[model samples]
Target: MRRGGAETETDDPTEDYDDTHADGEAVTEGAGARRARLRRGRRDSAWTRALESRRVRIGVAAGVVVALAVALVAYFSPLLSVRTVEVEGISAITDQQVQEALRVPEGRSMLRLDTDAMAQRVSELPKARSVRVQRVFPSTVRVTVEERTPVLYFEAPDGAHLIDSDSVEFAIEPAPIGVPKLVTEHPGGYDAVTRAAVTVMAAVPPALRLEVGQIAARSVSDIRLELRDGKTVLWGGATDSERKAAVVVPLLGQPGEVFDISSPNLVTVK
Candidate 1:
């Protein structure tokens, strides 16, 4: 490639290659060169080989299907159904009645039974204070009920209804043999004066309770008890009940028609 002057020399186009270098060696085209890094590692192990096998994949799928089939059979089959129900821990409500109240679904799987729902149904019985339902396994369900105990009886048009410690009117049966009637002028359940009378009756000793024929309360603070032997106790208010009961019992030993322990510290007798 001569230019415009006679003094210019032509350059060879293949002058960059060296004949002494082998073809395996790389020739750098730029000022800077870089080497690639290769990591040394072991071959794939048996665990990895097993994961990729067609037989292993098929076996896993079959296991999952069988497990699902077994679960469905157990949940829906009569073998796990409730064939028997037992009721316990009750006095007023009969065992048969408790079982009937439960009303658990017949032929239902024991494992799928909802104890809470069954207990709620049993709790509908007025006399049941607390209810518990348990799976007896295999094919049985057990219901345990705690019946409310009456502390006094409230007179109603139909009959006398029993009141428990929490002032709940549970049953309308005949008053228990020695249980006393409550007269509060306020006939409703848990009336202020009625609660006071209940408190007064509860504080009375068991011996005195047997002697109590009826309890009356004119107001929340003025309560009276008329005994079976025609004696009376003037027990005022729900407060200081324990002390007044203590005073009334020992003083009842002395001859008195009216045993006043309204003020326990200064008791009076008439």
Candidate 2:
């Protein structure tokens, strides 16, 4: 047969089928190649995302470390510097005396101040029995002193002095307030009777303290009390001081020249 612009022969349907099959195979191979390229691109993008996440984490961690280091340095460095010193609870002893006792100068590092050593040194003062020291941050130091209360005033070879319960003496210019004077023939009485007198005085009511004029102890057993009214109390010894003081107070309430409460149950008055 003759077709338009061409001569036609018998068509081989099997050949045409083979050509169509070959074309389908070529299209399938092209599609597979395109899919492979897309898969490779996705893998590269995922690897880039992982690397970026790691870098961000590393940067954050580094920043945190730097901030911590700076904070630590700033916190400790200023604590080592001291700016001010404050003194409290000191009356008999001067502030200068306490400062001299502590031996810690101003502008010295707070960390370098030894609290234990300073406390020990402060205790060496005759009046100081207990001491405490504290350091406040950013450069302030506080020292507190607890002084021994004088129980009696004694006359020594040096001068008149105030004596504490421990028999330790401190020199006072005007003497102590609210403390009784002790007169004795022997100076040794100050050491022997000071403690006993403190106990007796404490046991006595506050109303009777000013009424007491003098305590005279010639010997340990021969202790006497002189009242403001010029009457003598023949307190024989230091034994049963609380009981004796208890009895003496009530007896003194009545008009009496002398009262003896040395015996536990007996009240002898003259």
Candidate 3:
């Protein structure tokens, strides 16, 4: 203890090594803690994404429900319901008659009303030549009908059938005053002779048709039109009826008992 007056303490080399090892361990622990924090953050992000996806699905479902509810409300609402039915373009059948025929489902929604079906039902009327049904927004249904016009009167065993220009026999009623009486052996549709006579009547001018008393067809080619005055026109067939009608008025000015304008090219007044 007295040899050199400062019998010193020995320097320990292991202390430095222990300190360095401790520092390295602390650094490694810090890095591990940081990695754990990063992993936790990743898990939090995945959870958040899943939650957001669930929310989107819920929102879409809610939107769909809302849309469906709106549609249903519109479908059943009184605003879209039919409150009145209007019948138009009808004369032979009154509006009341057409309404009775329609029997339109009152208080039903216009959205659900079948326009095509209503048109078909209205078309079943004998006098309806053409029909159109329209949906009037918010409370009305409009039905438009075209009434068939009788071009001639056809006598059948049952009664007098009013025939239209298209040779369609629409109704059985008394013969109209001005329309010509069509006489044929056959009563119904298969008669080409009746069809020819009707065609000729339709082609004749209205003024001239007023004077026509009767049309007789023994056969299709043997069609003849008799006037109210004691005169006759031998119309051979249904062909060139428009031309034949044009030839008639001017040819009638000549003194003639019979006008043969059937062959419009070679017309004869005798």
At residue 197, candidate 1 shows an lDDT of 76
Clashing pairs in 1: none
Q: Compute the lDDT of residue 188 as modeled in candidate 2.
A: 35
- Mark the regions of model 3 whose C-alpha exceeds 4 Å error after superposition: 1-68
lDDT of each: 0.82, 0.73, 0.82
Candidate 1 residue 263 C-alpha distance from true site, Å: 1.4
Find the 10 residues in a row with the least total lDDT in model 2.
Answer: 13-22
Candidate 3 per-residue C-alpha lDDT over 1-270 given as tens digits, one digit per residue, 9 for 90 to 100: 245776755464322222246447532335456667789999999999999999999999999999999888878766688787888887788787687777777666788888898888888888998899898786888898999998888777788999887788899999778888888888565568878888788888777889889998888777888999988988878888888888888887889889997799998888
For model 2, name the residue pairs that clash. Answer: none
Query: RMSD to the native, candidate 2?
Result: 13.1
Winner of 1 and 2 under TM-score? 1
Better of 2 and 3 by lDDT: 3
lDDT of 1: 0.82
| Cα displacement (Å) at residue 123, model 3 | 0.8
Error of 2 at 248 (Å): 2.0
User: Which portions of model 2 show Cα errors greater than 4 Å?
Assistant: 1-79, 105-107, 188-190
User: In candidate 1, residue 26 scores what lDDT?
Assistant: 57
